[model samples]
Structure formats: C-alpha cells, structure tokens
Target: MESPKIDIITLVENLAYQQGTKGEHGLSFVVRTSGRQILFDTGQSDLLVQNAKKMNVDLSAIDAVVISHGHYDHTGGLPAFFEINDHAPVWLKSKAFDEKMSKSTGTPRFIGLDPEVAERYRTRFRTVEQVTELAPGLKIVPEIGSYYGFEQPSQSMLIKHGKTLSADLFEDELFMVFEHSEKLVVFAGCAHRGIGNICRSAMSLTGCNQIQLVLGGTHLKGASKGRIAKTVDAFRDLQVEHFGLCHCTGLPAFMEFSRVFEEKVRYAHVASRFEPFD
Candidate 1:
C-alpha cells in the first residue's frame, strides 16, 4: 500500500519563499497528514499566525501543537496560537519551560518561552520526557542517549534555574516523526541537539533506516567548517533521501549540502510547501 501523503506548508522562517509573506528569524510549519493538522513551532512572534492567515491555513483546525525546544524563536508565538486554537494540546519536552539564555552576541539574553504565556496556559501544555505517540502515527521523540563528539552544544547557550546558570545541554530538544507506510518523515524546529543526533535517535527509536524526508532547521549556523563537513558525512551515512533545510541551517552549510546532495536538497523558506511522499 502507498503511504499517506504528508503536506507541509512553511508558515514562518528566516526567508520568504512566496511574495507578500513576511519572514523572520524563526520557524513554523503547518503539517497536514492523515486528516490531521499539526502546528510545528510558533516562530518568535505573531508571524506564524499572520503568515498562516495569508497562506489560508486555518489555525483553529490544528489538531495539536508540537514545540521542538524551549527557545523563544520556536515557542514565542504560543500566546498568539492560543488566542485562535483553544483545544489542541501543546506537546513539548519536560524541561521546555526552564529559563534559557544565549550569550552568542557577547551579552546574555533570555531565549526561552515566555513565562507569562506558559503560566497562563499551563493546563493546555503536555510535557513529555520520553518517546510518546501523540497520535496513531505521529510520535514525539526526545533527544536521548549519546551524541557525536563533533555535534557538541554551543557554549554560549545557558540554562538558568533561578540564580544558578549552567550550560544548555538541550535535553529539552525533541523532534516529530511521521511514520507512513515503512518510511519516516522527520520534522525539527532548530535541531539544537544536533541534526545528526536527532536522526540517529529517530532511527534507533523506530528501528527503521529509511528516512524519506527531513524538514526544518539543522542549527548549523556559524558552525565550524569541520563540523559542517562531519554533519554532511553523517547525513550521507544516514542516507536521508531528501532535505528541506531552513532557518539556522545557514547558507554556507546549505550550500555545502546542495553541493553534495544536489537535487535532493532544498532550502525550505517561508510559504514553501512540501509533499515529501510525492
């Protein structure tokens, strides 16, 4: 039997794929599959809702909302989303509500989800610490086990617990897996735990090696050339059939991927639509 078609429409990203749609340094996608609609990430502002309106995506019909991590860029639009959809449960990792910070710009800045929004909609949030099946074929897989040495977390990322601050290990990072037929379609927000690690986790969790598509950020922005090379090698080893990379994947890394993967890779920008199963 053929797999069910999975249609992914980019609602927000750092670049715009269609005219009239604004872009921002964040990510959001409306995924439709098996008669269900899933909102993946909410971007850094109201762009998700605004773009969704322009694209004719009905936010009120979203069956569920999956947040890849605690970063503001991915979770900041929760308030806007809540205003429209009141029933869909927001799924995220256990530590997704913890205070997150980034010092990459030489000054510490809070990067986690808004405390007010999280507190206000606490009842609608569903925190998951392990592999969980949100629906029949949709699974929320947390980043677990070991990580490749080359895929280290950025030192500038920090997590705060009231007064104490520590390195952001990104334990809250997770990815969405859509199992169709015998193949997998992986969706990530920023891949803050490393795209390679997330891919490996998906393979290990499902015992399936055929990843028909991988869409979303790889978090390779400003990474070392060597690291990018190693990541490319990892992708080659994993045999990911198609890559729809965007956001933090960076131009240099995307260029390298396009050089290697060629026709199999694409820069998925805002308003871009992808049907991986097609």
Candidate 2:
C-alpha cells in the first residue's frame, strides 16, 4: 500500500500572538494522515487549550499524544489535556522520569511531566522505553543506551520531593520518522538526544538517509557557532529540504540555520500549518 500524504497543524507554540505583544508558554503540534490524528507534544502551559479553542481544533477527536520528553515546557499541558480528552493514548519514553536543570548556570528546576497526570493516564496511555513501532510509518526512538560524541549532553534535572540530582539522559527521549509520499518527515521534540545522533539513529531505523522535512524543536539554544555550523554541514548529507523549527530552537540559532538553508528553512510560527503533497 502507498503511504498517505501528511498534514501538520501547529496549534500551540511559545511565540503565539494574541493581539500585539503578550503570549503564553509551550508548544503543541497536530499531525493528520491516513485518517488518524496524532498530537506531537503539548506546550508548558494551558495555552494549548486556548489556542485550540481559538483555532477551532477539537481535542476530543485526537487519537494519540506523542510526548517528546518529560520537560514541563513540553508536557506541562497534559493535566489540562487529559481533562478534555481522556481516551487518546499517550506515548513517551520510560525514562522520562528524571531531574531537569539549567545548562549555563547549573540551576535546578522542575522539568518533568506531573507524576499525578502521568499516573492518571497510565491506565489508558502507553509508554515505551525502546524503539517500538506505533503504527504504519511511525516509530518511537528507543532509549539512548550510549551517547555518541556528537555534542555535549543536555544539562537538566527532574525535581522530586524537594531533592536535586543530576538529570539522567532519559533514554525515553524519542523522535518520530514517517514516510509521506516518497520522502521522510522527522518529528522531533527538544532533541535531548543529540540532533545529529538522532538523525543517524532515525536513518538506521528507517533505512532512508534522505530526510525531506524536519519539524519541532532542535534544542540548539546557546549552542556554539562551530557546533551549529557542523550540524548544518551534516544536514547537507541528509538532504533535508524543509525545516519548521520552533519552541526551544532559540532565535539566534534559528537565524543561523535560515542563513545557511535560505528558502529551505521556514520558522514554524504559532498557529501555522504545513501540507506535504503526494
């Protein structure tokens, strides 16, 4: 059977504009294809609900929710989300339960999804710790058994019972790769799993090195210029033709990628949509 063309709708993002300047926190995207609806991740706050309301996206009809990782900014809206649609299965990594931290100042923070919320969804949702295929053309990246020398590991922590500890490179961090027509589209979260490494493993899983489009956060905030440049060069090998970078991608890094990729890189603004043709 031939794959169906994929359509992505950006319902929530950190940079949402209500009228002029004020905005909310977090990011959320919806992917629809083959008569199924999949939500990539929920933003850090309830703006997802408000955005969906304003944008007219019905949460009740969504089939599944794929959490990139367990950061509050990405999974914060789950409690509110569950209140609206309690039946959709939630997919995430098993190790998403870790401490989060600040890389530059080494400050501790609350970054994991609410345990109460996660536990509540445990009955209806599904969690995977390894590379498991969820549906046709969709798979979750297994745990990071080893961290290759692509880039320095992320500096974050998960707060539990008022105790601060080094955050584990949660193996639960995963990305999705699906075939749209003849090309592959990668849906990533914060990319806590090194972006380059994620691409490498995703390629290994799909047996296709050519990525036509990439969406979601690259987590390149505060990245060094050399590292960003090297990443762009590596992308040349992957032949990524389009980019929809948003959320934690940071302004400076997004501009850098745009400078290099030109028309190929398009900023994924809040309330945006992309239609990939077959």
Query: In lDDT terms, which candidate is top?
Result: 1
TM-score of each: 0.96, 0.89
Best-fitting candidate, scored by TM-score = 1
Q: Tell me which residue pairs clash in candidate 1.
A: none
Give candidate 2 misplaced runs (Cα > 4 Å). Answer: 17-23, 101-107, 143-148, 156-164
Residue 220 in candidate 2 has what lDDT?
81
Q: Residue 241 error for model 2, in Å?
A: 1.1
lDDT of 2 by residue, 142-205 (tens): 6442334665556543334456355455566888877655567888787766776777776777
Lowest lDDT sum, 10 consecutive residues, model 2, at 16-25
- Residue 136 of model 1 has an lDDT of 65
User: Which 10-residue span in candidate 1 carries the lowest summed lDDT?
Assistant: 142-151
